[model samples]
Target chain A: MQQLDNTFTALSDVTRRAIVARLADGEQSLSKLAEPFEMSQTAVSKHVRVLSDAGLVIVEKRGRIRHCKLDAAPMKEAIDWLKYYEAFWADKFASLTKHLAKD
Target chain B: MQQLDNTFTALSDVTRRAIVARLADGEQSLSKLAEPFEMSQTAVSKHVRVLSDAGLVIVEKRGRIRHCKLDAAPMKEAIDWLKYYEAFWADKFASLTKHLAKD
Candidate 1:
């Protein structure tokens, strides 16, 4: 549950979500990651750091270059949490429909 | 995307997520919703305000009671976004496995 909080917090920023979206294609450098955004590399790197801290993305140092990759284990946790409620609500609604049908 | 940001941010807090989980069970008032937490009712209301602002939960007023319901439209959007990346990453891994199999 705490893990879900961190995951959701890290993903709260649009730029961070965009970074995750891009990395879903493949890993890339800080510059490449910042290419689509109007922000500086430093700004983007800060976002990546937040993601790294949350365990959403892993950063590797390849010589002097920083590489970012999607580390989706935390995301899987968030998704699992959300899915529980999704199924819960679905079941609730289904039961309601059944009850209505009888009336 | 802003909606996604708000949704994620709202869901980021453990207390708020807990509130959401409770609401998934059924609609309840501000006090009823605050029953399970160690925090004060004011604290819970503040968290619920954030969730209500995010559009993830709907707050209704009847007489003196404030009712909270899970408004899942935004959660659906967030899930849809995550599902896209989930599919993308799955495809990427599948292609990698295929390539490795050829070797």
Candidate 2:
């Protein structure tokens, strides 16, 4: 749990979101994952660590390579919780549009 | 927005999540929302404020009573981001099930 909390909190940063987006393409080595960004590899590693803690990503070691792959379970839980509120917003936006049309 | 970051960070707490869950039922007054939890009204208010800052909740003051309503928009954004990974998880789970069945 606390790890889960930190995971989402860590991801609240746009940099982390961008890293996750890149990882979504396929598994990549830690160094490869760090390449596109200006941040230090250590910082990217920290972000990856947070993602791993959240269970959003799985990291595996083989020979000299450490590969990171996206893990979906925690993300599913997060999305489900978020979806409840998405419905609320959809309804509110619909009502607003309807009122605007009437006006 | 730093406010958005803080809002999600604030919501990572279970107590705040529970409060959001309660508010999802319908709009409720500040004290009424605070009553179910043993925490102080001030703490609950702080949670509500975070929710408001996150655009997850709308607070309106009518006389001395402040009503809180679920806002839903920021939640939609959060869910959309989470959903991308939800799909990633679904695919991974499907593959895992297939592999397990083969085994």
RMSD of 1: 4.5
Pairs that clash in candidate 1: none
Per residue, candidate 2 scores C-alpha lDDT tens digits across A1-103 of 5654665676687777777777767778999999988989999999888888777788999999999987667766666667666666577667587347433
What is candidate 2's DockQ?
Answer: 0.45
Model 1 per-residue lDDT at A61: 88
For model 1, how does the per-residue alpha-carbon lDDT over A1-103 read when each residue is reduced to its tens digit? 6777788999899889889989988999988899889988899999999999997787888999898887665676777777765653456677356435544
Cα lDDT tens digits, model 2, B1-103, are 4654665676688777887888879899999999988889999999888877776777889999999876666665566666656655678676455445544
DockQ of each: 0.43, 0.45
**Residue A49 CA error for candidate 1 (Å)?**
0.6
Candidate 2 clashing pairs, residues 3+ apart or interchain: none
Tens-place lDDT digits, model 1, residues B11-100:
999889888877766778999999989999999999999999998889999999999988766787888777776653356776466447
Q: Which docking band does candidate 1 fall into?
A: acceptable
